[model samples]
Target: MSTEDIDVMVYDYTVAHGAIPAPLNFMGFPKSCCTSVNEEVCHGIPDKSVILKSGDIINVDVSTIYKGYYSDASRMFMIGKVDKKKQDLVAITKECLRIGIEAAKPWAFMGNIGAAIGNYAHKRGYSVVREFGGHGVGVEFHEEPFVCHVGKKNTGMLLVPGMIFTIEPMINMGKKDIYVDAANDWTALTIDGMPSAQWEHTVLITEKGAVSLTY
Candidate 1:
């Protein structure tokens, strides 16, 4: 299936549940969701020309606005028979996200999230994308507190209780260098053409710890 096919399904399903696809028309984004494949890092517009094939790994990022609230999440999918390296990259990327989430304790520094994720990924010989990272998103589609995936621990904003944000770390199998596609001015890809994977979760910091608002 093409990326546009994925967008249509997500649009219909979100509307069916009485929710609005937040990315539609937001900041001039035309798609209901983002589909990043292979070397594509993020902000990949859904296009009918982009078709899925074997060994392809894609990230489908979906955001929803419901009853004046917003939700964001993204997950990677392995198409057909993927290579061992690609599979490992996908698995390790997911693990990095898990580590980031675990480190996001209530009242902790926002840098803790990035530090944990960066350390784990770097130790595994992977790199984290720097151009884009997670952000505060609940009252609005995007908010303050730019959350980087690589930083020193105990720095940046403090994770206050009742605050909502996203922890999305784009882990690349090769170097971290990336450049934006000037054509659409949205899609970002790895400069070295290496495979990249990302996993995201909208989180809420509670008194006890951080909880994922998106599954």
Candidate 2:
């Protein structure tokens, strides 16, 4: 199916539930959601011409706004019969998100999230994309505290209770370099033409620990 199909489905679901697809028209982003395939990193505009094929991996980023609140999440999908290397990349990237979330504890520095995710991905022969990471989400689409997925622990802003943000790590199979598509000026792709994967989860830092608000 094409990325547009996913967009339409997301639009329909959001409307049916009396919620809005947060990404639609946010900062002039036209789609209801983002679908980044293979080398495409993030902010990939959903298009009818872009079709999915076997051995391809795609990231479907979905965001919702309901009752003046927001939530965001994304997951990687392998079409069929993906190569071993691509499979490993997806697995490693998912683990990056997991570790990133695991490191988000109350009173801990925001850099702890990046430190855990970056080190884990690096050790596994993967590079974390630094151009875009997670962000604060709740009362607004994109808020303060830009979450970076590469930094040292015990540094950056301290994570206090009742704070919420996203933990998305874009991992590349090749080098960490990336560039935005000039034609659309939205879709980001790997500079070396290698595959990339990403996973996102909105986290809420509670008095006990950081909990995933969008899972």
- Candidate 1 displacement at residue 210 in angstroms: 0.6
Q: Per-residue alpha-carbon lDDT of model 2 for 1-215, expressed as tens digits?
A: 99999999999999999999999988889999999999999989999999999999999999999999999999999997999999999999999999998899998999999999999999988999999989999899889899999999999999999998999999999999999999988999999999999999999999888898877
Could you give candidate 1's per-residue lDDT for residues 73-92 as a string of tens digits?
99999999999999999999
Question: How does residue 38 of candidate 1 score in lDDT?
Answer: 98
lDDT of 1: 0.95
My TM-score estimates for the predictions, one after another, are 0.98, 0.98
Worst ten in a row by lDDT for model 1: 138-147
Our tally of clashes for model 1 stands at 0
